[model samples]
Target: MQTFDQVIQSNIALIQKVVDFDAKNDQLLPLDFTAANTELTDEILDDTDLFSDWVNEKLAKNNASYGIGGYNEHRTIYSRSTHFDTEEEPRRLHLGIDIWGPAGTPIYNFYDATVQSFAFNDNLGDYGATIILTYDIDGFKFNALYGHLSLASLNGLEEGKFIPAATKIAELGAKEENGSWPPHLHFQLIKDMGGLKGDYPGVCKFSEREKYLANCPDPDLILKVTFS
Candidate 1:
């Protein structure tokens, strides 16, 4: 049997666009949140408005429609919330690709799926409103998580509902609702949910990086979004 990532790689053409990747008007700009990025000070990270302004400024400077990155990144921004804190280590390794964009931006399914679960993970620095959809490809099953969404997106969702490829599923939430952070869609793919529902660890401690990363592969295999 081929691995989950391998199956996705083989069927890449079938994975639909979650964003308007081919739009002539939209541009993608890469953003960095690693410890090495000295620009993001505690003062800015602590304030959602300031952090959002910082993100938008970057996009504006580049004349881009969205700010993107953060797959397997050791982000310093998590320090702003205790939600990621543990006794042994803080969860700094990002397990998903973050697409920074305006609130209410529509998110689409990349594959035909059944709605597995949905929830409002309202914790600070959390996923906010989240949705998980199950997919099967070449007899291999997996789940894709759409996080930091507007609560309104969950208004009419039903578990087991069939959502077609490229169907609009959710919209990005505002800073006040989206984990109190800047607006962004946290997209992750999980080979195994480990019995979680609606929410999964989008970040992990450095100590268990390999374990979590194995279960959650790079979303770009399907997204195919390149930052140039």
Candidate 2:
């Protein structure tokens, strides 16, 4: 059986920043929009549509990429808010590892793989532009998904394109190109999603945690980060 340990190593400098950010800002700090400007707070509450639009516009203006780590229950790493479809679900159970940085950050192919699928899931709450790559590792076949990417990455890209490990497959997109929030890369690994294509559930109900978790393991296994 192939393990992620046999795969790629992470960038140490980037990992340090993630660790440092959590330490300095209190990983459990509430997503306090109240601390922000009145205008911004009103926009977030009163006009979600306009607020989302503004976020998208800002992403286009500033090219950003992120390397934010995903949720860590033991460490108290949590999402600023909950948007799960159900109350029975884990409030902040993360479905993927977030590399939070800025848009346009170069995303490398973890290993030699062929593009299996790609799509522009443009919805209010969805992955803006996503790509899925499949490959073999130590005799085990697996898939790597790159979500919230720049639209340009999808242009001229087609299924079956051979992507070598560490190849710059795409750039982290601005909030607009990405589902509009912060610039970050949503990296996920899937064992099997059944017949699902062009769309996969990145978040799930806590009641179904075990099943979803077994299907999606910690991406840090491949990222090579020492989670605290």
- Global fold similarity of model 2 (TM-score): 0.68
* Candidate 2 lDDT tens digits, 63-182: 322233453222122232333345454444557776655467677876678888899987644678999888776556667688888999888778888877667778888767776556
Q: Which candidate leads in lDDT?
A: 1
Candidate 2 local accuracy as lDDT? 0.60
RMSD of each: 1.3, 7.4
Report the poorest 10 consecutive residues by lDDT, candidate 2. Answer: 11-20
**TM-score list, all predictions:** 0.96, 0.68
Off by over 4 Å in 2: 1-67, 71-83, 86-92
